[model samples]
Target: MTTLRLSVLDQTPVGEDHTPDQALRASVDLARAAEDLGYTRYWAAEHHGSPGFASSAPEILAGALLAHTSRMRIGTGGVLLPRYEPAKVAEVFGVLASLYPGRVDLGIGRAGGPARDFPRRLADLRALLGEGGAVPHAPVPPQMWLLGAGRESARLAGLVGTEFAFGHFFSPVGGREAFEDYRERFRNATGRPAGGALAVRVVTADSAGRAEELARGLLLWRARKDLGEDAPLPSYETTRRHRWTGAELARAEVHRTALVSGAPEQVHAALTALAASHGVDELIVNTLTADPADRRRSYELLADAFALPPGGPETTVAHAARVPASVPAGR
Candidate 1:
């Protein structure tokens, strides 16, 4: 069996009736909770011009997360490399890596608003980090994780000799083959064994009906966004009031696969299949909901469902503190 480790990829969603600041606070609080729950890594993603998301700068949010938690890994779920300067990115992560050391990571992707020279950008980033001239802390570079969904990204990351972080949330059709191709390319081009992680969205509740209800809100929000509706995500009650149009319904149908939800058994089964299918070393989860309590509960439920190690005995510590633990630790 492939050993599976769980991590987080937060979008800092602005839930219904909440402001962006509250969303950011929830992310920080959730990071603390994630640490207490023994999640290996907690990554924040960068999303621009989205009323529902507050994480425009994952690097800064990652720094905040590092300040709040003592041990969990923090990084960008990832940074759009083509959209930013490689030198600046190097400097940003260099400062973070020096401050946080092994706990910092940089997951970069060439997608959605990008140029064609991704491999070149990666090389430039590495080169900038190695120069030791512009950055005071250039000696300590953060771990690089290339984020992508298919073979081209796999191949690019392989050529650049960085780890791959595959996002299968929006696209999972050829996940297995893409991962396989990445491994093959890594071995052939880099002549080294490389580890890869998977990213996907998951929704869970106490029962199937409740989980579906949670799904309806997120699905409807995404459906609206896809149709160029820029308004913030509405409450589930409000969403329930809107009658669906045929065009919107069509978009919703395509987005249904992006949602994974159910009771514990069903959620675990789905996650296990996803892990087994890609043979991923880590499964990074993204859960966005109208309620932070519900979101936190979902993660707690997932932690139980996966039987993930209690990083320490103090697993009961909530979002605000990191108390000492009494149980056996997980890897």
Candidate 2:
């Protein structure tokens, strides 16, 4: 059987008035919980000027998560490469690798930086990796990965000598095609053996009914975000009030192509079939449930269904030292 790796994108409520410190602490706890559940990696995302997804500083968050866990590999689902100087990113990730040793990964994304600022950011990043830079006391050059929604990202990943990870779950191309495009380009670009791999994220649930119900909220939020609506803590009820039409619903459904929702045996069969058909090297499962308890349950259910052998620390609910009082539960 193909090995399945469970990973999480720690997202915080955007509209809520939570302090950054509180948000960081909560994210750390979540990562630790995922580690105890025998997850392979824990990742955070980069979002700017967005209230609904507050994890903008993935490097700092990666460091914190790394400090809190001993086994699980910590990384960014994607760092917005267009936003920061590549050198700074390299420096930051290098420091993290130094600190965490063999456990650091740097996942880069083409999104994040504003279009107006992209040129400068791209230039700086290139310069940093190109020439003279101060070496660290303990160098931690990260194993880089490129995350993109299209072919350009796949090509870039090949050029950069890093692993390619496509956002198949949220991208327009869906999973199988995206995986194929990435793998083909990776092989062509590097002229290396087909050993280099691709990783795709998906949302899987125990049942179609439950998955649909859970996906309703997630889909609605994504639709609203795509439309550039910035209401705070927007819920499914609010989305229903807006009345999404058939065309909009169809578009949303298209984006949901990678999602697998069924009974345990059914889900396992579907995922295994998907893996074989696509020649996917790694399957990164991203569950949609927001409630921490529900999220944990989802992980357990998946583990049982896949028959994943368990070998990790037991799950423990650590007392969050600084819970943000103003966090809006964006369920």
Highest lDDT against the true fold, candidate? 1
What would the TM-scores of all predictions be?
0.90, 0.75
The residue ranges of model 1 lying beyond 4 angstroms of the native Cα positions read 112-114, 130-134, 138-140, 312-331
- Taken over the whole model, the C-alpha lDDT of each candidate is 0.78, 0.58
lDDT of 2 by residue, 107-216 (tens): 76777556456435533443343332524422334555667666666555454445666665655245456556666655665555332233433344567666565566
| Candidate 1 residue-wise lDDT at 261 | 85
Which parts of model 2 have CA positions greater than 4 angstroms off?
12-24, 113-134, 137-140, 172-191, 194-208, 232-251, 311-331
RMSD of each: 7.4, 9.3
Report the lDDT tens digits of candidate 1 across residue range 1-331.
6556789999998877889999999999999998888788899999899899999999999999989988777889889888888888988888887777667878887865644576677777766655553385534466678888878887766665667888888686777887888788677765667678889899898888888888878888888888998656667787679798888788877888867888978999998888887888688999989878778988988988888777622322222211112211111
Whole-model lDDT, model 2? 0.58
